[model samples]
Target: MKLQCEVEVINRMLPTFGMRNRGKGTRAVLSVGRQEGKRGAIYLMICTLKDKAGSRYKLENNIEQLFTKFLGEGKATIRLKEPALDICLSKAEMCSLKNFVSIVGLANKGSDAGTPLLSQLIPAKTSEIEKPRAKMFITSKKDYPITKNFPYSLEQLQVSYCKLARIDMRMLCLKKLQKLDLSNNHIKKLPKTIGDLICLQELILSHNYLESFEVALCNSTLSNSLKLLDLSENKIKALPVQICNFKELISLKIDENDLLQLPFTIGRLSKLRLISAAKNKLSCLPSTFKMLRLEKVDLFGNPFIQASPMVPDIQLKIPQTLLETAAREVARYRIPYGPQLIPATLCQDLSMAKTCDCGLSCLNSFIQIVVAMNLHQVSQTVVLVDTMGGTDAPIICYFCSLTCYSHFLDKYLQSIRD
Candidate 1:
């Protein structure tokens, strides 16, 4: 088995000899396998790119003692007896480390007894075990090397407090990148291409100069992969309605912004469980806001409008336009449509179609009513919206037809009269 990790060779007799170590460690590939043409002989190899000639030891009877010391969080130490050395491995995943430990233990047994261990220990080519894969990288300005290059194998990267104005193009090319933290920067705008990181799950962009969450990003592949998003302490004025496209989003933080309102279709984010919009300009929530089953919600320090009983207005029926009729039919039946298959403007109109409480789509022409709703109905933990400790807030409800509006009005009036 070949494992990529940071390796440090500590001489067991160095302290006794009154000598101090010169360097910390080097990124290297560790290989454990049997040598070819030599039966029942297992060899352990450590190779670093900087040195073509690497250290090798025969595990069969070469060791007086062996120790596997697991330091929590993907770090371990392997001590060899005869060599009097400590092989420290860091950034090695748990599974890989376990496999290595098992192989070394089996080799130490030196018995041809159990199922033949030689078959499992296949010799690796020099080219195959040269480059170490760096999966996790965290760097700050203090220790970050100017000439250091980011490994393509990186899965998580954090470069906070760097004062970067824009994202590095090289970072975007990391296809396997899953978590990225670029907080406390001077970035003013985000490129839509950030959504191309399909494996990305958590994105931290708090404490920046960003003015808006790019609408194009909401329409990208992030709608499926992104789970947590942080945009706090930014200069953002508003978020696009399409922000709800992230169906996998569980935690959303947009605190300290100038948001006027949330998306009316925010309930479409079925997986969302936590949301914080504290210290914003929101006075009320969307009618569909009650659809969320959030665990925690914070809307503190907002100027929420006082709640009052809504009085329904009876009006004549308005004829729906041909575009609106088509949009409704498309939305109702869940027809597959997009800009690639239809006009972009038509697609936009379809996307903006509203849903009535009765579960019918309405476009352009629809009865609109604002009613007070208790925020506690959707969230278990809610921050008080007003100093009065009241949780009721107004929400705008839409209806596809007069009949639907009348149906809702009847229920509303009856509930109030109770």
Candidate 2:
């Protein structure tokens, strides 16, 4: 049986019949060659422009019209005997023989020595043709091929802008598939069986509505082989603690989510070099995060509060050089008040005030009065006041800042006078 082979002209050009434009004459040429056994055929149609006086030609159109024309023929080559010409016709049979001869003369000046026309017209073997996989584009449109779960096989699958309601791994059993993109879909969840795809290296799940990831993804089978995982633009509130299992993960993107905190187990992902969690609602991070060996981390738009020393220290020690640098950063700024003073009303309000008319001297006096009014030291005085009040004790203001310093002092003096 003769194996049918396809020779598509991915790029082509037609020679111009008229005079040179801007001193350059347009030319087109198709080069074809084959190996011992006819495994497959390759047809390269190049459209070039050469200065009327120059010997070299410049390539103009990279996508040749020949491929489009050949696709319509359902065959790679066409042979004709009436004219005693073994002519290879592409989908664009519009190529004129006179123009082709002119292009050949311009492209191959010396090859005119003895090669026959049929030899030049034959297509080359498939090995000579470069095959570039199509880019994967995930979309949310309902009519996309990936939405219907066709049993199709491809090196790269682009399903961008598709409204995918759900994903069932069993239906997509493409064994040779390498890159799978499901971005811009409305998928709310992923099947745990996704780990079955042992050969998958790149998985893009960005711009989806996923709330949580399947725990099965962290299985050793998937984690050890997976290289890049994009889970950006999701509604995930928290990442699975098992994510640390993906020791081989080179890049993990979870940006634009509702995550409040990172799991402490994240520190175990020592191999992770890049992690992006920007645009989230994180308020605090675990101190164990100090163990990460990340090259870059994106934590922008997350309300992060510095952790206190009371938090558990990371088991792994940061290099002394880094610690010294961090210490220098801390030494740059010093808070005047102790941590205990943070809850004081005067401290809270005055620290936040942009401008306070009260001069430095007045502020110093207020601070002194507050320091002197330690209510915890006068338990007996508090009990006597409570007993005299009978049914209910009068609310007493204890702190003596600028707001209450004069009133407390006047009341004490009036009691003595009475």
Candidate 3:
């Protein structure tokens, strides 16, 4: 999902696989069930099975030209270029499908062929059967409700593209849940009990209305195991310095927000491998941002001045493939650029120069008159953050003097709070 693609393709390939056909795709289900070990199941459904006539015939054997691997599932993350097929199957039914072979009339609509297949593969009564602990839980639909009761044994739960706003705090009962996705929702805040799910490793809350973090999320127990946190496409203004609580966080995405600045405490997350903070109002990053060995760092949309320390060696663009840990980079990537130049000086080019929050652009730099310049007790400063290195990070100030920087700082904070 990282590499943007059209949902129109899903519509084209699955014009019939709508809500009405959710659990009613009996023939389509059997066709997929018969090809348990055989690969290209998704490609077959998308490309080969164009219509009912296409799906009725058995899948071709010459699949050398066609290819798709069943990458291990985790939270049902569908990376770009990877085809995904949806189905609903109980654990027992899944166990029985391994030996199922496709029969002549089994996939025919309105035929009795499916009765024998189901009777043989699935037990009639699941009442007395002992259900296995849940490993993967997936439900994708718009306006889907989040139930209060969920199995504690679940390792992955994907409730993406739903209209859920508030998740029941009882979900913290899942002591073993590893991956949780509540993306594409109207959620404003997370439950305080979310901190109790210490086993959560990858949490995706992207495309929501979250303006800030839950106080309980700063707990060390949850931070110790939470590796990936995606908070992109939200209303977040700035991340608290307490976010450094995620001691094991490897990737952090706060893109598409109203963020004016990032807390210096982020440097405490030594395990952080990537930072996606594009499309924010940030003028500069924290001093310690350049100290880490990040695989990817995105700050393309920020109005960074020349004093910012972030080097331009890394590309701001997301790789065509998945992240390195999730993809194979077969070739070198040419990261795209989006105007990585500092604003012009007022004395030089007014057209390109950025005015200070105080409405004055520093045109001259000479002597220092602290008291006269409102610098008696001022610590805040402003300057153009450097996009390609050469920033004094220990205390990054984008201004030529401290007074203007301090003035802007107070205004920026107040704006975000409102």
Supply candidate 3's per-residue lDDT for 248. 87
Model 3, 230-253: lDDT tens digits are 999999987776788888898899
Return the TM-score for each candidate structure.
0.67, 0.42, 0.45
Best by lDDT: 1
lDDT assessment of candidate 2 = 0.48
| Candidate lDDT (C-alpha), each | 0.79, 0.48, 0.49
Q: What's the residue-level lDDT of 290 in candidate 2?
A: 47
* TM-score ranking, best first: 1, 3, 2
Provide the global lDDT of candidate 3 against the true structure.
0.49
- Tens-place lDDT per residue, model 2, 258-350, is 998776567677777777776878765542354566666665566544423223222222333443333333333433553385447545333
> How much does candidate 3 score in TM-score?
0.45
> How would you encode candidate 1's per-residue C-alpha lDDT over 23-109 as one tens digit per residue?
587777777766667755677888776653557777766665545556346677777777888888887767877777677766777
Worst 10 residues of 2 by lDDT: 355-364
- The regions of model 1 sitting more than 4 angstroms off are 1-140, 308-317, 335-342
Which scores greater on TM-score, model 1 or model 2? 1
